[model samples]
Target: MKFTIILSILFCTSIWIPQNPDLTLDTRKDPVSLKEAAKNHFKIGVALNERQLNGMDDKALEITKQHFNAIVAENCMKSGRIQPVEGEFVWEHADRFVAFGEENNMEINGHTLIWHSQAPRWFFVDDEGNDVSKEVLIERMRTHINTVVGRYKGRVHTWDVVNETILDDGSWRQSKFYEIIGEDFVKIAFTLAHEADPDARLFYNDYSMAKPGKREGVVKMVSNLQKQGVKIDGIGMQGHVGLDHPSLEEFEKSIQAFAALGLEVLITEMDVSVLPSPSNHQGAEITDTFEYQKEINPYTEGLTKEAEQEFHDRYMDFFRLFDKYSDHITRVTFWGVTDGHSWKNNFPVRGRTDYPLLFDRSYQAKPVVKSIADFLQNP
Candidate 1:
């Protein structure tokens, strides 16, 4: 009797100790990188500025390599920076950016082949400053797309073929591209991109994606494109959220709606701004500007514990949402790696310190990083 009792106790102990030894606690304490922790869910990515790619910021580079498995050029790959002169292309910074991604085995994303805001003045105008004919603009676009996309070809994994073409009210922005080439400019851009690199995935990226009108507009536009046999592979919903704005329900609805169209959905350019902004601020418009006020920039010294917790909670909620739809979200990319590198500081309201990234100014991962990893690992 005594021997049997001892044997039973030992068997129970061995089973518990060997098979399930405090998995939850162990995972929480484990220093798993974000990419590894979320590998099963979706790819983790970050935007890299020229400084990080040029070896000027070793600390940022190290953190990026450690935590991110995908990367996008913040500004270097944009139309203005890549080809400032019409025929003269700039390759130094862009080449370094692509090479860095390849050396690290990271999935590279080409930011934008065409955008109205950052496009060169000459692209839509003649020497007399008059808008070019539709044919002239189309040829210029073809040349630019062919030159840029053809050069990268197999290297870049995805391309944001057209950006910010639709407005918040579901109407097309009357930029030079639209005024001259009309809505077909979007079709032309996608076709040209496809011709440049058929293997590369193409995406239509935009902000204010959760708005009802914008969501419906994008759905209609993409549906029309599909009818015409456009090779669009995904829809990039720019995740530029605030602590309070962008209702989670609405965002999820947009995701489902986009996915219903049989296209992959990507949460791109994600960041949470903790600072107050003008009530009129609509979306991630780079040209929007406001005069600075001390009340708006309250956290110049540091975020108070309350504010920090709010920031943490905001991030946690978004990550939870992203995880819930992991099957539909192919990638979740932060706009910047560190709070110091984030454009939030100067966006809309200038010179306001904002803690809006997974890493702090000192290159240390915030508690939210581990919290996110823990949740994803355990959930």
Candidate 2:
């Protein structure tokens, strides 16, 4: 009876081996990056500036190469910066941006094809300084899209064809394109982008995407485009989230709704500002600049322990949410690399020391980075 019991125990303890044990990532690597940690889930990206593109900011570029697998031009690719004057394409900066991405094997995203701000003054206004006629504007739009999109035809994997077109109230933001070409401008932009690079993905990026009205409106608008047989592949919810505003629940709703519309969701421009706002809630707009004040820039010394903890929690929560919907989200691109590189430092209120990004000013990973990296390690 004792021998039988021993044999049964040995049989029960026998090991079983799988055919593909390597399919699971060994997450025990130390000092892992946000991009590598979450790579199996989805891509991690960062936007680039002139310094990084020109190889001036060696530290930022090194961190980028180590951690990130995707890149977008922070300003160089913008219409105003690239074109400046009509028909005079300044391709040097953009070329470098693409070259950097290609060398690193990173997925490249073109920031914008049409936006009200940051375009050459000549883009919308005529030689007489008036808004150009619809025909002239559409033709100019066609040329701009074709030229820019055609330049990086297969290099850029995705393009922000139209940016921030809808307001929080679900109404179209009136710009030269809206006033002259009407809503059809969105369709035209997508068509031109598709014509320029049919293989590349096309996306409509916007801010305030979590609001119910805006979410609904974007769904309907994109649905209409899909109905018209326009190949809109993704929607970029500018992740310019704050510590408290735009509740996580609402943001998830935006993802679910967009995914329901059969569109992939890209969390573009993600950063969490941990500073008291001048107004109720500030936005990421080039026109939304403010005069620097001593009081608003309170964290110049450094963030308080409480504030830092809160910032860390906010990031972990958002990333956990991102993990939850990893299937629907194809990419999550931080707007900047480190806290020092963030635009939030001067946005809405200038000179404010906002601790909004995953890395500190020194490019060291913060607690939130560890939290995310740890999570990825475990999974």
Candidate 3:
């Protein structure tokens, strides 16, 4: 009787254990590419790094080819990376990146022509380390925009002409660009980009765009540019979000407001960070840094089942919102291709393992990929 009781107890324990369904794409009988799924709504894109473009990360390149229909260089096209010095231009990586997109027939986007961050030291300073004069700075801006945009004029379709210029409080960030050249810097940058490639679409890209103050600021700026005939094309809302901030209502408001100004709305640099933020931080300021804390980096082992579900649900909610505004939104681009490749791993607080993409570390598609594919395909 004791032996019988032991067997029954073991069986009951086994039955109570939960089973996780296989979420990888290989296991799925019907796998759909996100690009194909969202083709009718908006183009699906991903940021590509040098490794992926150079064939170093074969899995990432394969995933990029299979899933994304648009490509943007994550860092190579940035001002500092492309032109670290005054006159010298490094075109190897940027050239390779553009070629890869062209080979794939993907819509290529030049990340930025002018920005407060990642700009070369020489861009804003003189030989004696003082700020360059307004005329000198304007010339530098013109040369950089002309060279970069001119290289890929007809090949590249869109450019983030100016990035992160507006502050969250509806004021300007007062970067060296603004301080040296004043507010006309934005207009000049757009004008130079347009002159470089009249056929290419130009955009102003920024983060934390869901704030009412920021929304109003961008609308005013874009509206003013439109009125002045500055050749502006669209606004990129950098979707660097977390689990609980930038409520969908607020994000939708920005989308509506930007679209109301006759500008194409592109959801750019999107990543849903699953780790606990450092002090409720929502903006994607690359310079923002904080010391690493154990509590803030809670998911070092991996995301919990509950956390994974929450992550999945959060993405679905955002996608639903995007679908509703598909008429206004042109393209939706993820910041990175896989969780391991995500900047979230070392961002805000360095050395934290974070799962914040549709693909896991092994290049396997999470259930959310299939769910999104199914939802968009069927909807």
Candidate 2 regions with alpha-carbon error over 4 angstroms: 1-30
Query: What TM-score does candidate 2 get on C-alpha atoms?
Result: 0.90
The sequence of per-residue lDDT tens digits that candidate 1 reaches over residues 177-288 is 9999999999999999999999999999999999999999999999999999999999999988888878888998999899999898999999998988676575898989
Scored by lDDT, model 3 comes in at 0.88
| Candidate lDDT (C-alpha), each | 0.87, 0.84, 0.88
Where does candidate 2 have its weakest 10-residue lDDT segment? Answer: 15-24
Model 3, residue pairs in steric clash: none
Whose TM-score is greatest here? 3
TM-score of each: 0.92, 0.90, 0.93
Which digits, one per residue and each the tens of the lDDT, describe model 3 over residues 1-379? 2234543454344332224333433633445899999988899999999888777998899889999999988999999999999899999999999999999999999998998899999999999999999999999999999999999989999999999999998898889999998899999999999999999999999999999999999898888888898998899999899999889999989998998888899999998999898988779898899999998988888888888877877887788778777778999999999999999999998999998888889888888888788767754
For model 1 the local lDDT of residue 117 reads 84
Q: Which ten contiguous residues of candidate 3 have the minimum total lDDT?
A: 14-23
Error of 2 at 371 (Å): 1.1
Superposed by TM-score, candidate 1 places the C-alpha of residue 178 at a distance from the truth, in angstroms, of 0.4
How far off is model 1, as Cα RMSD? 8.3
